[model samples]
Target chain A: MTGSLTLRAGLLSCILLTAFLVVWHLATRGAGVAVEMDPEYAALMGATATQGVSAMPGPLEVGATLWRHLRDPFYVNGTNDMGVGIQIAYSIARVGIGYLLAVAVAVPVGFLIGMSPLMSRALDPFIQVMKPISPLAWMPLALYTIKDSGLSAIFVIFICSLWPMLVNTAFGVASVRKEWLNVARTLEVGPLRRAFLVILPAAAPTILTGMRISIGIAWLVIVAAEMLVGGTGIGYFVWNEWNNLSITNVITAILVIGVIGMILDQMLARLARLVTFPE
Target chain B: MTTPRFISMEGIARRYPAPGGGRTTIFEDLWLPVQRGEFVCVIGHSGCGKTTVLNILAGLDSPSEGTVIVDGQAISGPSLDRAVIFQGHALLPWRSVLGNVTFAVRSRWPDKPREWVEAQARRFIALVGLAGAERKRPAELSGGMKQRVGIARALSIEPKILLMDEPFSALDALTRGTLQDEVRRICLDTGQTTFMITHDVDEAMYLADRIVLMTNGPGACIAEIVENPLPRERDRTDLHRHPHYYTLRNHLLDFLVTRSRTFRDSPPPGYDRRHPPVVRPGAAPQPVPVPETGDTLPLAQFANRRHP
Candidate 1:
């Protein structure tokens, strides 16, 4: 039943895409009415003024630009110009490093908070205050303190990724069934062994859910952080294309960003499924 | 008495602070002893703190007042020597039947090789009649099967005393009967000392060697301890056919329905916390001392009257 549902959904998506592309093609088709003008002024004015072509790039233009970028994705043209793949790679690398660093800090600290009532109460105020702050709001301080644009962007990613996972891990650990802990106690399982074998396994699904949310937030924040830092990332690429007024390139970057974000979310979702137990 | 009993609770009491100020006692000055290989089931109404007593015995929860002594040693906390089969079955849902059993086996014998631990677990699993379902997770199993896994896990550790908190109460009647039969056979065959808590009188009569009755709570105490009159080798299906079955069952029912509520307020004359009256409900009536206090009467008089 699910398989057939998925197939039908896929077909519907294709139909929607086709209809969108056809509408875009017709809407952007150049107006046949010609304006007589000075050749020199008309050359400066370009296609929109001379041929009455729509300024917004049509689906065909975006597709052609996407294919071109895909054909030579990793080429670096200088300090200012780089291929789409390199920009995507830089963004992923930053998110990966910062997110991994967040994981290292969040999970263990979350465990400590979850396990100890004193620590949980002590840290709760700080988490509550910091959780609502936007990741980009920290960019100014990060750049000031870290004194490096690239590192500042990573710091933002790390901060944005930290809260969801930390809160989730703590919640998960704190809420493990009392009966399971009683089982461990009765078995005389040592504190460390109990934490690893029983508590960790029991809390893993919830922790992974936190991680899934963190990764998505990290992906989102990295784009804005890269835009602020003016560095080599997909977010920077989009900003740069917008500055050059190349609507085709900007649309292509948006599509790439979306696809990469989806892939990252899917990977974490699969990981969450692996740890989730039925009961 | 000669060997200091295999398990003993000495004046253990559990209490929680009430909303206004003073503490509300669940049960207090509770004392009980079990000889080795004895199967004792505590029967009580919902608020009587039977589970709290079982938890105290298991060392999962410490009594607010006194200590529990097992095999000459006072229990400091939960120990490997006492294994609890929880009411909810409490199987680690992520683990398979074999894994759950193996977890306990490994805990009991940490240095044992993987093969040895798994083999020991498999033996207990089969002993609980779950041999072929080793790979099934708790979520995949029926309620009865999950509880069977719990029994297997508890038994695998070979604890000196097995503690079960209404292990079969959640199961359907048919499954409860089958599991009870299997557990009775397993406990009897292995000579495992067990302390169980349940509200089911028939279950107490069928499985327990002695059924300890507790009054309704707010300061519950053991009202009486009725010795089961059925033979040790009795079968579940034919349990009702026994001559003493109805007598034993009715006495327990009567205590729970009426006496349990009034027990704390008006305990029988000569009722002792240290030694509650031990009555064999189906036994012939015997002469007993009359009460000195006009307001109090001996509870045993009613038990004897009910049967005779």
Candidate 2:
């Protein structure tokens, strides 16, 4: 019965998504914006030829266009491009690179800052002053200095992701118990072992919490960053659809983007669960 | 298990830097001639520098005034040779009970294989009566269980001296009783030389072969040292039934409580003279015993734990 209920919930979710798409289809199909009649679209072609009417393609026409391109690809990621799959792969790649870089540097630096009072106090002023500025604010400088749109986007993601990790690392390190340190001393664990075995594990959950927040913020920034640069990311897809005055395409991209972001956040949440309280 | 002198701390005195700068003498010119297998408990009021004194003996801290020579060697920084079981267990929250014990062993004897270490730790987990719960973390264990882990960790090293700083004081009454009995049994069985500090007079009276009573703080000294006349195998549950138990408890109680009245009422020597009543109202400048001198009698001079 429990298994059947889970199946029912799964089906219900698909049904709800379909219903939402249908409502979206109805609302945006013939709504105010004018789509020039295209001869290539079969339904629009019939209306254009029979009634001499300039009938733009509707929701179904766009779906048919999307369906045609779904599998027929131009190898964007290893073997596939010019399709929705490749578009997703491209965005995922950017998020992965940018987020990985952010993590590699931030975690160590954060730990260092956290472990030492002098470092935390020394660097605190800079972090506080920099964290509040909009991640978008770095775009202009990144574009000019970095000399590449993709690199600029990555740099923004890096900037957005770093603050959480660094702050969290500092906090996690600072909160390790003095008694625990005493245990380390008594055991005669060297400084390196003390940090890795005792201090790191003790502070791991908090550090992961910081990473989760950092990644979520990074995911949020990618969309805005892609919108700024006219590229082949999911964010660019939204902007491109808006230009054609197709609200349905815009809404579809929004849904896809939201779903992808949720997946990314969940991945991080699972990672957080794996490195947790020690037994 | 019978052995020679395990721990010998001779002429130990500890002084702390007075808040501003100069040293405030806490203890001075002391002598201790502990045998290899004897159990000594120090009973003192708070700030008697009980913890400080224990730390010095444990090699966690150095004596600002005198030296602690242990097992024929002058004590240095923390070592496995002197195992300290601190109050509150001091178990790492990250490790299981077994892991905590094994870690202490592995660290001291780094060359020992993991399998051998595991076997050693397993033996002790069963010995402490936490056989099945070895995998559970410190947080999952009761306070008493955690302290058992602490004891197990201390014993794992097979150190010459076992130093405890009020190991059972933090526990609840029942748990405290259980641990006290377990500790007593372990010490007796192993014949490990032990030094413990506690505020509980009964705990001191019940556990120690001899109880060392410390005077009140701010340079408090040892007022008295009473040897427990009871047998080592005496039942802990019925300890208070011993006629000397009440008598000893009363002596300690009177020293801690009733004696304070005398100190409060008595004026400091030479308070009325030199300084006028206007200078310092009703309070007379009391005669604080300026510590005469703190000199450590060489630990080698002791009956045991002496080197040629």
Give me the candidate number with maximum TM-score: 1
Compose the digit string of candidate 1's lDDT tens values, residues B246-288.
9888899999889999888888787788777888877862323
Residue B95, model 2: Cα distance from true site in angstroms: 2.5
TM-score of each: 0.94, 0.79
The DockQ scores of all candidates, in the order shown, are 0.80, 0.42
Error of 2 at B253 (Å): 1.9
User: On residues B95-122, what C-alpha lDDT tens digit does candidate 2 reach at each position?
Assistant: 8888899988887888999999988988
In candidate 2 the C-alpha lDDT for residue B233 amounts to 75
As for candidate 2, its interface RMSD to one decimal place is: 2.6
lDDT of 1 by residue, A1-279 (tens): 556988999999999999999999989978864798898988898889888899999998999999999999999989679999999999999999999999999999999999999999999999999999999999999989999999988899999999999999999999999999999999999999999999999999999999999999999888888888886999999999999999999999999999999999999999988999999
Error of 1 at B25 (Å): 0.6
Q: Which residue pairs in candidate 2 have backbone atoms (N, alpha carbon, C) closer than 3 angstroms, thus clashing? A: A74-A81, A75-A79, A75-A80, A75-A81, A76-A80, A76-A81, B5-B36, B6-B36, B268-B286
* Residue-level error in angstroms, candidate 1, position A58: 0.5
Q: How well is candidate 1 docked (DockQ)?
A: 0.80
Question: What tens digits encode model 2's per-residue C-alpha lDDT throughout A1-279?
Answer: 567987999999999978976875665454332355554664645554544433444557667756654556344543212455566676778878888898899889988998888998999899999999899999999999999999898889989988998898889988987777777777777888888888898888888999899888988888889889767777776777688776656655665678788888898789788768643
In candidate 1 chain A, what residue range of length 10 has the lowest lDDT sum? A29-38
- Checking candidate 1 for backbone clashes, the offending pairs are none
